[model samples]
Target: MASVQHPFPPLLSQDSADIERWLLALNDVYASDEVALIRKACEFAAPLYHDEVDVTGASLLQHALGSASILIGLHMDHETIAATALHAVPNHLQDWREVLTTRFGANVTRLVAGISDMERLRHFSELREAAIADKQEAAQQVEGLRKMLLAMVEDIRVVLIKLAERTQTLRNLSSASPDTQQHIAQETRSIFGPLANRLGVWQLKWELEDLSLRYLEPLLYKKVAKLLDERRVDREKYIADIVAQLQSALAAQGIKGEVNGRPKHIHSIINKMKRKQMEFSELYDIRAVRVQVKDVENCYAALSVVHELWPAIHSEFDDYIANPKPNGYQSLHTAVLGPRDLAVEVQIRTPQMHHDSELGVAAHWRYKENKQSESGFDEKIAWLRQILAWKAELADSGEMKEQFKNELLQDRVYVFTPQGKVIDLPKGATPVDFAYVVHTDLGHRTRGAKLDGSIAPLNTKLQTGQRVEILTAKQGGPSRDWLSPKLGFLQSARSRAKVRHWFSEQNVDDSIAQGRALLDRELVRVGVTDINQEKLAQKLKFNKLDDLLASLGRGEITPRRVSLAIGQEAPVNAPRASTQTIATSDGNVVIEGVGNLVSRTAKCCSPTKGDEIIGYVTRDRGITIHRRDCPFMQRVPEEREDRLLEARWVAKTN
Candidate 1:
């Protein structure tokens, strides 16, 4: 590979110096062969990136080196660091895949490819905030793009590498144009910072958020920084005194621990002020210290000694060791008044917990490596995804933390629109569902669809990373076939409801005309015509003749059911059964063979007195009554068939 000639010369002395520095920095963590591999990758990438500058006007080779350095700080594996060094190779070389594979190995090649794939998402990020009209929709689309970024990569390291590259870009963002700076900062604050937070990369999360804030809100950032700077000397002196006292106290108690002052970032400071509506001086954590011990017991011992040394604020204490966070973060947090009656915060945790706190999911790579089972890795990924889903709620309530314990990780499929917007759907979502999610009008007018530039069936199950283009008509409604579960035209219940609503909203005259024609045919088939339609409608519990016809036209009522009601002699107000009746609060539904059971109508299919219904036994809720032909009921798995029971309408007794 070294023998192959290119436009660029061999590594210069300066380039060699940079490579040596990188290797030296990584020497403690990486083996000799691993260090040599990183050196080779850096050498290979340096030439391809020669004379190349990124959008920030920084040397591409320097950018790659900066990114690798960040990964090294995370203690990422050699493969990840090497891949970061060569991440931009695909943009520089056409045959980069084969070259990387041949020189480094298939792992490096895959990592580089994953990086390239993620880079394509940068285009969406640039346009997301500006192109979207509705703020909520734009926020949702941004979330979709985040999930798409994760779905695009098979390896989690790819995401970490991408995060590192973004951080490097932000660090160099000062040299870029104002528009470019604002764009990059906004994207980072909205996407990458939250991503790092979710992945438990506190080291990168704090920096990314702080840098983005510096660019996005320069005035506020400077204000907070100025405040911290003004107090830096006195704060440092005070923290140093507290650290010494805590260290001596811990030593006297036979507790071994490392205590250090914790630095507070500007963005978090501003956030704390805004969230709690407090002045910076009132914040207890501004002057904070963290203690790292050897074991869980030492952690408690250190905490006890700290409290003994200072007056502890009862409300400010949190015992997270007994209750770890959803992301597996464990530490004891407390706020107290130190010497001079100054407020101080303290955090106590084991060294392993400290390592995990700093590196987050990145620490898993160091220990689990090849030993982690696929299922276990998937659980971690699921936790990250859940964090992404409930990020906003997680900040406000401890109850939301308990909600995270229940794994609600459903399989999701992410696809792109014609204009590069991401749309997330369920595992088996179809084009009609996609169309409805985008816009109900678009879904109603959808005549066909094309997947990846090729015309496909409307019922085609979408996959992640596919580009979907819905082919719509000028004016039309969805086909009734979409509501049929067996046809698989629509997979989402929301989409099916939209289709039903469209039919339900049709012109009353037209619906009655269509229904009358169908009913006349059914009557001819049964060889009966003199039947009074008004009495028949009354027997069916419809207020008027047109209501019955409209229900028939909407497919909510079948013609054979009209024929069945014709032979019955009971009046509309007749009361029939006194058998076991399990009525709801409104006394509408009666579950057969069951009594004294609470029941409620299912929101998915609100069954009325005249509609055919069934009962489903729920875990907590006694029983849920659903329409017999509800799409949700039809989709219930065979394993849950035992939950199904017979239910019917009991005539009202006045």
Candidate 2:
């Protein structure tokens, strides 16, 4: 028998030096025990990932190490690093869960599980890209997917790990096939890059964007790169000279600050060029420097020194410190004419502002999302970003772990359609609610649903990340049971309203039919079968025949009244009800042929003044008045009809 070929690539030989270097990179931040735990995780993953290569044709172990390194650059905690190292364990090891939990601990296991859960979304991302034809629709789907990714994980660190893994994959994407490269690059640019930007992980965000652009728009990427390289040496020299000049000026003024040249990213350059429709040379921020001060006072002092050193471009200044960006980014941005009359952009801010702009929820998310106000979810995201910003400082206190597990956006659940589109709903939303959200027609025809490939009840509370496939009929309407509050069929108000509207429409049609039947019977009995219904409806003060019929069917109009309106004498055989009217002295209800009896508005219907009312005689409580059209009143049994009495509201005299 021939040897069976495995679907995956052969495992590459292990390298001990690679493991040593990875641990060495973390030695400064992690204590010895923590480092040892991370080392053990790497060692455990090494043999398991033996010879198996990822899509990029890199060994799984190398890929894991690369991802871990990215997270380390983000200053993530030890558990995040370890989880990154073991992210692929579930794919290679069946007992991975128990093994990871037993050896590495529960937190690491949970993080690995989260990574694995997120990995499943890759196929959906591809599907979404292929399914959406409209650019605007595709953009909306991408935004939903980004939120879904965040809402899916309990630990925000899992998202950081996922971002790190994507960054690493892009780093080694050159080895992949052309088609694979394009797909990966596009996904990174659309999804992961924005996620990184939102998390304020500028370290990974910049690399992700630059690398993705390098593949997605190769020609443009090279053009920007070449333009920057052509002036690389000169720009570096110019920025360095400006930085030294600013440092000297600030020092001379006795203001303590640190000045450094800021590297311009190719993607951002391209973005600005396209956004402002300006050439690379016209961009003011291409050769930029940042000044970090100790306090707000020092920030203004540094800004003053920079402006005094170079003539300021009044139009190019932004006082973000006083009026910060929506994402909590605070900095003073200004453009000044530097040496040789070159435009030099400078940003001045305190250290805290600098940290926030780089590692907190800065302007990147708002810039990409293009949303003006912060939603509840965005508020929670801000909290998550704060945790990341404080992770390093809180690492020794062990509070980072607790903070990492704090679930956010729990009020919303994000589910996927069969076609891979993400649908966001309120938490506890059911499959029926999902259907309604997708389309009202779909919701009306929805008969069953399959959640994650298995049949689930229509009322099954959908969870985040589940792929829901609604089984719809060819022709149908929604069920009344969906409107029942106790059934849990719908949790969203929008969906519930849709179901109610469907039923109300059906009821209106039925009422019209019933009204027509009753009116026809009355017309025949009164010997006026030849009368025109349209004219009769107009005589009865109804704008439409259907409206007249609906009123009659709903018992809002009596057959005797219709006969009288049509100029027919009442038949002696017809039941003779009291026609007496009683006016109350206090502008309260007046029951015909009844007086001196206590009456109270029914709480169920709350019939108020000016409402057509009916008195339902209770045993102890004199009479419970209800609206004539109230649902409960309509359902009153025939045996109780004798106890009911005609009632009307009498307006008070001025």
What lDDT does the true structure give each of the candidates? 0.79, 0.75
Candidate 2 lDDT tens digits, 348-460: 99887876666553222231123353575466564653332121234335565465446345667888888888887888999998888888999999999999999999989
- Which regions of candidate 2 fall more than 4 Å away from where they truly are? 1-13, 24-26, 361-410, 507-509, 512-654
* TM-score (all chains, Cα) for each model: 0.74, 0.71
Clashing pairs in 1: none
Which residue runs of candidate 1 sit more than 4 Å off their true CA positions?
1-14, 20-28, 93-104, 133-137, 367-378, 390-395, 398-410, 419-422, 506-553, 557-654
**What TM-score would candidate 2 get against the native?**
0.71
> What is the total number of backbone clashes in candidate 2?
3
Clash tally for model 1: 0
Judge candidate 1 at residue 327 and give its lDDT: 61
Q: What is the TM-score of candidate 1?
A: 0.74
